[model samples]
Target: MSERVTPSAEAARALRDIERRRGQARAADQESRWVGVVFGVAIFAELAAPDFFGDGVRSWIGLAVAVLGCVYVVMLRTPRGGALLGRPTRLRKDELSPRFVWLARLAILAVMLIGPFGLRFLPQAPFPYTRTVVGAVLGATLIIFGRTLQRALTSLALRRDDKDGLGGATYGSR
Candidate 1:
């Protein structure tokens, strides 16, 4: 005779595993969103300095913002123990491709570095006008990344739910 397994016991084990995975995915998603927002804000603030601060003050302010952004990025690059940001638990490898991550990082850095000189494209462009435009672009980029992260997390959550036989109710859905 084959050994018998209790249905309740099996269900409980599955439920527990599912909960554990869900928590990991949620934490990963939160970290991704926070990183994107912080970087975006830093870029915007750095570029906006010219609008509010005089040349001498704006230079220092922009340098401060850039340094902070660099520090945050460095923290993310460090190992789990050294990370200033919390590590993700259950995020799938393919959910965030390394190539894409690098590309996004490079793009953000380029924007931050080049944004201050955006006014030069239009000779004699007003400081306020250039700052406003650059700030808007940086803000939009952040929003785009935020949406991308949300979608990635949603898809990951959906995949996990399906794998766990949790049916069609997605984690973010009602």
Candidate 2:
């Protein structure tokens, strides 16, 4: 006779809870990723628009788009949400530490505070080149931060999956 093992009721309940939490975490991760993309787009728009965040029509449009993105980001918050301006998810043990969350917020705040001043101080280069320069800087920053956000989410999800004895590796987790 072959021996078989079945989960206890308590174990089954815990597994269900883990599955629910994982699903929520996955949703939160996706939402967080979208927020990062929107943030990047907003930064790019603010920097790459014709007059560099002025009162012109293009600037107004850019601001409107950014504001809408911000609204969407805020709407993503769940009952377990954490780090309003940064992580955009519940706390995780292996990833998104509180210190890291604060650091991410500070870094973003620094960019927000310093970017415009840095641009103003820069020597006014030729038009096309100036646009290219701003685009490159902001675009690069966006890509970097987007990747970082994605990695954090992926790490958190993978760690949770591991803790819960979830069978599959997700998002190329090692």
Candidate 3:
């Protein structure tokens, strides 16, 4: 025999579950700040290698760095890696605006395609260390802005949750 659950009780339970999951996602986001630093350093090394090493050595270094990055990524998918590195979680569709999400994706894609080539074409005199400069700027951006961006996205999701009738919850309060 099972007890009946009222609609209000079920709704409350569902809201509680949503809050729990959102809390976990926020924790995971905080834990992933270090990941940005790791990839930032890797990107800087890959780009800066050519300035300090010969073509052959640069290729080898780049290969090694790429392999390491790939391995780290693969490891992050494992249980132990998730414990160590924090597994990333996706926001529910209702928690994000599709238009904003698509715009962000497109912007990232454009930067990925144009950034390196665009840097190469800059005047040599003003930007002698073009690759290094770009790498450092990108690396620094990742390391420094990663947490900030995460907070912004988290806030956006929370706002959506509030709009959906869940009371607004602050990251600190969670």
- TM per candidate comes to 0.48, 0.49, 0.61
**Residue 57 in candidate 1, Cα distance off native in Å:** 3.1
Off by over 4 Å in 2: 1-28, 31-46, 51-55, 78-95, 126-129, 136-149, 153-174
* CA RMSD of each candidate after superposition: 7.9, 8.2, 6.7
Question: For candidate 1, lDDT tens digit of each residue in 69-164?
Answer: 678667655655223455433344444445566776898999988966774686775654687587869776885677576656455334332542
Instruction: Tell me model 2's lDDT, rounded to 2 decimals.
Output: 0.58
The models' CA-based lDDT, in order, is 0.60, 0.58, 0.69
Candidate number achieving the greatest lDDT relative to the actual structure: 3
Q: Model 1, stretches more than 4 Å misplaced?
A: 1-23, 32-41, 77-84, 88-120, 126-128, 136-174
- Clashes in candidate 2: how many? 0
Model 3 lDDT, residue 43, Cα: 84
Winner by lDDT between candidate 2 and candidate 1: 1
Worst 10 residues of 3 by lDDT: 165-174
Error of 1 at 155 (Å): 6.0
